[model samples]
Target: MGNLIFLSGQAAIDQIGGVVGPGDIDAQIDQAMANIERALNAVGSGVDRIFKITVYLTDMNNFESVIKMRERYFDKPWPADTTVGVSALALPELMVELDVIATRP
Candidate 1:
């Protein structure tokens, strides 16, 4: 049976709990996506196996930049997703958070 893995939301915070990309949406998105990648690898899955994802953004205005930055993480056959803009996250400085669901072979 294929294994399904659900990764918890990853914000721009590092493993040490330090906020990343304080004022830059691009940097925050990158760090969040990178954190997801690391989480996936830890569980024997990867970005290509990602079937669905939910992205949370602090500002809707950063949509374009988030999509552009997302290209660096996901390729052409991108995963299905839903994105929502929220007023705040767990931390005041957190800007982007990614929720990943993937299958593990």
Candidate 2:
């Protein structure tokens, strides 16, 4: 807790408790990233300070989409990352989930 922040897995569920995108992978990825940003911002940190990230996906075929979307969030020397393909997530409708470790500001 000194300088690191461990965030729980963030899914596509929005601020209102509804999935942001039911069957859209790209939209889901965006929402999950937004959620991650929100969590980090709440503590005075932002995505630029993330040191590591773990991604979960219900379908490995969507990995390419994740890669493309990731470029929008992180730049060169990106955070350490690990992506896993799971059979399902907390909600069946969810397609992607992201969790990250970042430094506190």
Candidate 3:
């Protein structure tokens, strides 16, 4: 069986070692993508190796902008994904959070 990896998304305005707060959705999404990329790299994988992803959004109304940001992270044959609008997150300021699953040889 292949190795499995779980990654957490990164955010820019996110506190370096603290909680996230209400922030720009676009910036939050970008940070989350960066976080995911870093996690993948640590395990010798890249975004292209991802097989699945789940996005947690505090506000579903901004889904369009979130999807647009997501497009920059993956290419053709994009990995399967699920987007969920939740009542709240670990941090109130976090408009979006991404989790990823990847396979490695």
Candidate 4:
């Protein structure tokens, strides 16, 4: 079995602290991706190493914008993903939160 890496995307977003407020869907998605990437790199893996992703969104209707941002993080043969519409996240202002599983050589 290969080594497994677990990361917290929320920590990365906290570093960027962009103009996009916490409640904005697009902004949250973007920050989430950044956080994921940062966490992956910290573990010596990149987004390409990700085998699966689970996304929690405040509203399923915002999936379009989420997909648009996803394109920037992943390319062809994208990682397996599961998204869910949840009533809330760890943070009240967060519109999206992502948790990923990655393999490392």
Which structure among the candidates has the greatest TM-score? Answer: 2
What are the per-residue Cα lDDT tens digits for candidate 3 across 8-90? Answer: 55443433665433467776777677777777887788888888888888889989966796588788688888998899876
TM-score of 1: 0.91
Pairs with steric clashes in candidate 4: none
The RMSD of every model to the true structure, in order and in angstroms, is 1.5, 0.9, 2.5, 2.6
Ranking by lDDT: 2, 1, 3, 4
Score each candidate by Cα lDDT. 0.84, 0.90, 0.75, 0.74
Which regions of candidate 2 fall more than 4 Å away from where they truly are?
Answer: none
Off by over 4 Å in 1: none
Report the lDDT tens digits of candidate 4 across residue range 1-105. Answer: 558887644521566464345657776777677777777788788888888888887888989976786688888777788888899776667777788888887
Error (Å) of candidate 3 at residue 13 is 7.0
Highest lDDT, which number? Answer: 2
lDDT of 4: 0.74
- In candidate 4 the C-alpha lDDT for residue 46 amounts to 85
TM values, all candidates: 0.91, 0.95, 0.83, 0.82
Which segments of model 4 are wrong by more than 4 Å?
8-12, 16-20
Candidate 2: tens digits of C-alpha lDDT, residues 27-92 = 999998899899889989999999898999999999998788769899888889999999999998
Residue 67 alpha-carbon offset, candidate 1, angstroms: 1.5
Clash count, one per candidate: 0, 0, 6, 0
